[model samples]
Target chain A: MENIDFSLVDWSRAQFALTAMYHWLFVPLTLGLSFIIAFMETLYVKTGNSEWKRITKFWMTLFGINFAIGVATGIILEFEFGTNWSNYSWFVGDIFGAPLAIEGIMAFFLESTFIAVMFFGWNKVSKKFHLVSTWLVAIGSNLSALWILVANGWMQNPTGMRFNPDTARNEMVNFWQVLFNPVSINKFLHTISSGYVLASIFVIGVSAWYLLKNREHQLAKKSMIVASVFGLLTTAFVVLTGDGSARNMAKYQPMKFAAMENLYVGQQNAPLVAIGILKEDSKETLHKKQDFRFQIEIPNMLSYMAFLDPNAYVPGIKDIVHGNPEHNILSFQQRSEKGKIAIRALSDYRNAKKAGNDSLAKVSQATFEANYANFGYGYYAGRDVHELIPNIPMTFYSFRIMVGMGVHFGALFLVILLLTLKNKIDKKRFILYTALWTIPLAYIAAELGWIVAEMGRQPWVIQDILPTIAAVSQLKSTSVQITFWMFFILFTGLLIAEIRIMTTSIKIGPTEDLKDSVKN
Target chain B: MKEILFNIFQFYYQGFKSMTLGKKLWTIFIIKLVFIFLVLRIFFFPNVLKSNFKTDDQRSNHVIEQLTK
Candidate 1:
């Protein structure tokens, strides 16, 4: 191979990452905020309270601003995937393209069409129809998330697919397998719950601010109660689903799990490290035997999650990185051949798993060796067996932060729930401020969690199946850099405009309730 | 039918007349310029057309093959 410029890949990756991060700043709110708005409208309808109605209208105005920016950011993502990662488009386009198309045709169109009715037809439509429209928008956003999760999950687990060298791609070998892939369902729930957490916290925070200022006190108090209730439920659910999500990661993506957990190789019961400085170069041991960097004793945590057996072996990151000697029966060329074999083996294993043929799915050492040797372009792309394993330090820290926030929010949610139930929410001054502080923190946690998930799976855009270096577009660094600058300017302007609009709307207070509502 | 056509013509004619013809012509010129810009965008800067499909002819062929298959 010729001497490739690594800087090209680095610059392009940075540019795409920046744009994606900027776009995401608008997305989670659109997902979660829309749902809270709908729920608030539901309360307004149920209670026949003008305060609830006003609160709903205020939130809807913010939601409208968020939604507009979300649409803009979302549009940019579609163009960007092709612009920034043309090679990824060619490879996974067959399987990945399906869900995106479905999302556009089904979810996005549905959401956009009904958004007008929901926002504009408040007076024109009946209360029941308006409420239904609100719900529809929420469902549309989540449905959009569902299809997107499916695409992303496929990259993590790579189910329902087989590689076609002629196309240099993995095509959908089974539609059902792709849809019901192990990671998709868990990821979808996890993503939606995070969205809810973000949405609820935003509501609670804004409402608390109003309550603290003693402006719209009645409306603020009621809104805070509703937001707290939603926030608490979703936050608790996010934590529970988070464990399930991690376990799911362990099951289908053991390498990713190993990286996240900072494991070395197949070993006995392992401890869950709560916090520690990860010295990647240093070596150590748990019980004065096995070599490792950092070790602890929690007795059977890894085995319990991964294999459901305390004694079952769980591989660590180092062991996976420096292959196990027990499985060392292959030449370099043979190992390259075996990589291709392993893919087929995995495909067969998946097929057997679906068909309930465990005996047939058990691939032999020879088969494994052949597949290990010939990992094809994946080998050249540095997705060789070693690098397919995740970055232990990065993954470990990322996973912990995500889990820690999940726990923190879980506790915070319950407190809100208890306070709201007792009708003592508004009275608790510190609690109100805590809810307010949570708003920005919740968004920050989500952004961090996503970075961990995506970045932890780095060097591969499509998990083990595709390397990141090979996946980026063939565009020059200057082109991507220019576009990035342009988007940065545009998005900043849009954000300032959105804030100005929101301030004016809040100041005006929901179109004077009736007369000015008609005038507008 | 003729009366309907005449009414439609008179409506736009009066609308333009109310704008005192010069302003109406300027608006027309701007609209034409926008259309020309859009056409040029499709030819020169395909990104402005804003589909994720690659701008190259190979992508067009690939898309056709995908459709047929």
Candidate 2:
């Protein structure tokens, strides 16, 4: 620890932030756009509508472009995790490697193989076969998301795994336990719904643009109705899933929950702060450092969300780190060793109460808790345990932005549905001006929501277990800078090329321009 | 054993006749590259790095040495 510089930490973080932001620009579209294309194709099959087929083909071209860029950006991430955080991967490879390998061997290969056929075999393949291909692509994209979330869930909940000092790596003790972790289900649902929101908004947006131009009125109307239905379902599900995601965090990652709530002291009842600058306010009458002014608390909301009991106590960050008997137990330097003691104590209590010698079972459970406690201790020792977590204010604001947009879109969808009901969708005002502008905002909200969930767990790459500082590559700062530059250049070039292909495809307008006799 | 040998030869003869000369060379080049990649992975790498690294905390350091090398 002596004479080692912390500046590389800053450099690596900045580089990662940039690369991740750039990469994310393409990924959501790949996740969301494929679903929209599949919906269009399914509609065509259902209604025997030629326009629906055309819409499916048009969006399929855009999806192809986005998919290619997403893959290009993503492949580098797999290598960078190793190249950048050489030590971290070696340390957690036993657990980390499993999800990643599954993602590659199972999901990536399935998606890529079918994608080529879907993109190029439109005329060559039967209609039913093509539709199946579209569905496969959607399944493949989501399956990839599922595996990545499993890896992340292990970090958040630290389940089904333990670090062996002899091996110097955390190994998976139970495969099923790792897959069906308490946090994974909620996080997976939340992430996938956000992807749906992104896809629906994009479909609605481009269709509205055509409506505004009065270019493809009939096609645009169909696209809007289908997109609106998807949008409504996804938006509602995102909100419900967000609540579940928060509750999961509260149970397993109390520090993250407390940080997100910005609750520093233990309290019987807590209020949710809406928005404001967080500052230390010293008052003449009171000695307490008031964290915020003009803050509003919704009574018992957090308790209801976290525990399903309105009066249940939610531990604050201060309580978790510095207060009371359990807090002190966690704060000790030899905390993992202390964990062994607690496990033994619990075992004795259970044995005495049950009147049986289940010593073997007790020993295993003790070992599990002891190893987990050690990992937690490792995280705290590396980072500023208090400030180094889910950036509370950012998460709080992003969560609201995402929720606000969801509500706003729900209202917008209702208004559109009303206009459609009145047989006024063909009317100029409803079709041209109102719906067109609101389309872009949906994707924005989706992006912000994801930023909140992922960025919220900062400082630690793996929640409660590994600090990002410990999880990243230990290469010289200059090496990271060079690779970062190389990636940025390559990614930007691919992004531009993808945009050009999409633009040309849309401009050329669905291969009909090459028709008449060029038809197969 | 004789039948297996005969079948292997037949497979190689069919493959040779099916492809152009340039394609065959490219395929051979890729195969050789893969062979080198596997060799570097197995005996040459982790073993060579393990030899170079000597310290109390040798395990993690050994991984880095192998990966970087």
Off by over 4 Å in 2: A2-4, A274-290, A326-372, A376-390, A421-423, A426-440, A496-520, B1-58, B61-69
Task: Grade the docking of candidate 2.
Answer: incorrect
Tens digit of lDDT per residue, candidate 2, span B7-45? 656645554454332243345344434533454224322
lDDT of 1 by residue, A1-520 (tens): 1334466677767766776777677788888988888888898789876666777777887887676644545555665666666656766757988988898898657886687667666665688898999999989988998888899888877878765533445679898999888788888888888988888877777767766666666666677667777877887788777778777876655657777776655677765566555665454633112234455547787787776777766766555444566634233234334554654554555456558776765553235334532343224433345434445566677677767776777677677667766777777889779877877778778877777677767666776555665565555667666766766776676567656765565655554463343343
User: What shift in Å separates residue A127 of candidate 1 from its native position after superposition?
Assistant: 1.5
Q: Ten residues in a row with the worst lDDT in model 1 chain A? A: A285-294
